[model samples]
Target: MSKEYNVAILGATGAVGTRMIQQLEQSTIPVKSLKLLASSRSAGKQLQFKGQPITVEEATPDSFAGIDLVLSSAGGSVSKKLLPEAVKRGAVCVDNTSAFRMEPDVPLVVPEVNEAALKNHHGIVANPNCSTIQMVVALEPIRKAFGLKQVIVSTYQAASGAGQSALNELKQEAQDYLDGKDIQDDAEILPTKGDKKHYPLAFNLLPQIDVFEDNGYTHEEWKMIHETKKIMLGDMNAKYIKVTATCVRVPVPIAHGETVYFTVDDPSVTVDQLREALKGAPGVVLQDNPAHQVYPQPLNAVGKRDTFVGRLRADEENPGSFNMWVVADNLLKGAAWNTVENAECLVKDNLI
Candidate 1:
């Protein structure tokens, strides 16, 4: 851990990929060489790293030669194809895709929630879903202090979570609607770009995030349900940890917010006690103040790297039931920052 390591980012030109570079630059992790890899079309593009120019390379199986760490934000197909190639070359991969998330072998980690799981990585670690990442970071402390029993969450995700093109579509559609012009629905991207149908995300909420599953829940919802149980159980049969989720896409450009309801094992835990626990939790920013209407907002949390939680209150009918809201820069804490943090955990613990 003395000498800096050579790190490669697999999808360097995309939204979360670019933020990974930014997070690396801001991180205390000493990096010797930075390799930026994208699709063939994005190769040769120039990017900045601590003021020096770094050129993007096409992501191929041979891209991992001499690489020590591969922080990837590429899609599942790319990860499925290339991650093992990187690992074969002796590089540890922190993948930000759904490809290996639920694999019994690959550890799905949020550094704030389950850094201990890093010990089980077999050269690959999966980052949790963006919506799941923020929600769990905000709730992990509560779960530890109050004892989580049953939980429910609904997400208001931002367009930036969809990628750069989705942001453009949102802006253009909003402008078209505002000008009273004939709005043409472009079916290229959105809701799930790879899915069958695309809809206008401007001035609307798309109930679906990823492709729908046979059981009626979209993949996004399933990710939240499964990932939460995995992280909380730590190898136990988490079947009793009742969890349900509803994911919606909003017009926001950055930050994902969730309103979560949960029943704790401790009925004596007051809102004041929960507030105190969240106030001092790592990777969480507590912003609760009902009188001032202070709570987590997408606009205020766009570029920040911390999960903000607020709106703590008791559920009116159910004793021991409580509700809270959470927010975080979806691309940062939800993706890039968490990826980098996992890599840092490996290095800090000498696991790699």
Candidate 2:
């Protein structure tokens, strides 16, 4: 009989956390028990898993007793605080936050792109940022078929990427705009909640996703640039690969779309060759049929675990350069599903 392990879903009350529970149920990981964990206020709430209602419990440091795996999406600070504790109690954790992603010892992974990185995990595996996740998934196959040199991406991220509260605010703002109320009056969350200014996202696009760094790039952009490098190439080779990103938050409620321009080392690479590379790539769906006007869209990508790639075209001036549009359910493939997929990889590799 295959061994079944006890599992816990941290941040069980949040958007991505709840999706983690759903993904876990759909995953192949054999779970002996499922524990839902969240903050004190959210404790005692019942969340269904495989038709069974699991009561969410307060996440204390001691929550990981006898647990074999932990899927965490609880914000960076919460992961920073609880994951080490989970590790201490012998649970292998997959974190969906920026907390330990850049840590030298912690492996920042997108299973499709870098499942091998999981081998080096010191009990915690960091999931790549949501925007970074979808882009890398589409790029990996192309990079493998033709060596990658540079990547430039502009993302149209959804309001859901901010959190449940931001999604709520977006809906209210949209309704207020239709009702002739001031949409800007209650803007408190887009483009980074802690930033000095909040902008209405009802029908507007905010170029900034997170706080701007000294270099003028928002933290979201920084994450994509660095995380793409880290996942595509190891620390030694990461610096050699060039990556840059401009992240924008659109008013859409779910799924993120990105316009990615990439240069491959092989100058002779063609659009058809790129399509062939992505045709059967793991975790990717090729939707490029411009002749029929079919392409990946945010609405169609929702609730799906696959990253959709379309609009493939060669760059006019830059030889071996191509551009494509990629979309994925930010909450599913981006956060929750990726976290669960990491756990599945761990189990398959017997790391957990």
What TM-score do all the candidates reach, one by one?
A: 0.98, 0.98
lDDT of 1 at 264: 90
C-alpha local distance difference test of each model = 0.90, 0.93
Q: Which ten-residue region of model 2 has the weakest summed lDDT?
A: 232-241
lDDT tens readout by residue for model 2, 1-352: 9989999999999999989988999999999999999999999999999999999999999989999999998888999999999999999999998999889999999998999999999999999999999999999999898999998999999999999999999999999999999888879887788888989998999999989899999999889988888888867237767998999999999999999999999999999899889988999999999889999999999999999999999998999999999999999999999999999999999998
Clashes (candidate 2): 0
State in Å the error of residue 109, model 2. 1.0
All models, RMSD in angstroms: 1.2, 1.0
Best by lDDT: 2
Runs off by more than 4 Å, candidate 1:
235-237
List model 1 lDDT by residue over 7-109, tens digit each. Answer: 9999999999999999999987789999999999999999999999999999998989999999999899999999999999999999999999888988999
Error of 1 at 252 (Å): 0.7
Q: After superposition, how far is residue 294 of candidate 1 from its true place, in Å?
A: 1.2
